[model samples]
Target: MKRIRMIIAAAFLLIVAPLVFSCDTTEKKVPYFIINVKLDQLTYPVSSTNKLYAVFFVNFNWTTPWLNLSSSRLQIITPPLNIGDFPLFFIVFYDADNSGTLNSGDIFQGWDGVIVSGNNLTPIIVPETEMMLLNVDLDNNGIVP
Candidate 1:
């Protein structure tokens, strides 16, 4: 009788232990809001001092109204620049009221001007919101797309 009881208890513990340990009741997938950003011009030269512009459209269908759209950050990725090179600037626009026009105050500006003598350029995000126009001066004289 003692042997039979021991076997049953072991079997019960083996089955219950796995069930208790493997159960996950947490929520996994959190839906993210999608925003589409496009460049005004499709192409740019390798080395030039041309003005680059981009437009961003925020799709609020999946996003809640409580979410802060204006406070979100913007980023740009570029290659490493040579010594004493000028940084690239980015202008971001947001239509918070769903208006068809992007007004003067609707613009967000940022720049990446760090001179790193390497092959890869790190991504930089502008922390300021006052500047809207990005003036990118490629020091390498290479046309950047």
Candidate 2:
């Protein structure tokens, strides 16, 4: 009778141990921002070869990976931004030369005075509800204007 009671207690412990021990306790913290892009007024004819990319400047600079320009609406997820109010000169361009660098004849536009305020409290957030309209019709002139 004692042996049977011991076996039942061991079985209960085995089942409950995994349930309590398998819970995830450690969470990695990463903060980021999302920018929704609107290209409705883009006059340049985008094609499969034309890849889209974005870059922003604060005290330094940050860039996004080249994205396929497959739709009029797009999203750019920024890398982890530390706490600060960074004034951004946001530029989005098509890599028309396919050289993986900004050059002349690549159609693009920019938004000046865009501010990205980042904090460590949240993992992801959108800074604004209005989509950034791309219609300025700027291009790389191989010289700073």
Candidate 3:
């Protein structure tokens, strides 16, 4: 009788194991924010080759920035980004660079400090605005002429 009970228990476990360990088959969709930046009014510098790029300042003044993309003459549309664990915010930099270094530029339009989350999203709009520029001479010696 003891041997018969053990066999029965083993067979029952084998039948129930797969059901207990089964996982959901559905894939979850991630939420994202839509950022719209209009750049029709920007003034191209004299030396500018008219090259423009768009910068994403992830998480509100984060010291490290995300990848910047080449911008059209009119606007930039961002891909969906998953929300971070901490406070969520974003800024867009409409970048105009004449110095060849895409980062160092003579004109910048900064759209700063936007809290992005929740279902009722308002398309974050960044209108054209003249922003402070950083002129960087990466290879120039410390001596100033």
- Which digits, one per residue and each the tens of the lDDT, describe model 3 over residues 28-129? 433343334433452432223554444554444433456565544334444544432333333344334444333443344333322221212122332222
Candidate 1 deviant stretches above 4 angstroms: 25-36, 39-64, 71-145
Worst 10 residues of 2 by lDDT: 115-124
lDDT of each: 0.33, 0.47, 0.40
After superposition, which runs of candidate 2 have C-alpha atoms over 4 Å from their true positions? 1-31, 40-48, 59-73, 112-145
* Model 1, residue 116: C-alpha shift (Å): 44
Candidate 3: residue 131 Cα off by (Å)? 29
C-alpha RMSD of each candidate structure in angstroms = 15.9, 9.9, 12.4
For model 3, name the residue pairs that clash.
Answer: none
Of 1 and 3, the candidate ranking higher by lDDT: 3
Residue-by-residue lDDT tens digits, candidate 1, 39-130? 23323221122222333222212111122222222322323222122222222333333442333323222224322222223333333232
Ranking by lDDT: 2, 3, 1
TM-score of 3: 0.39
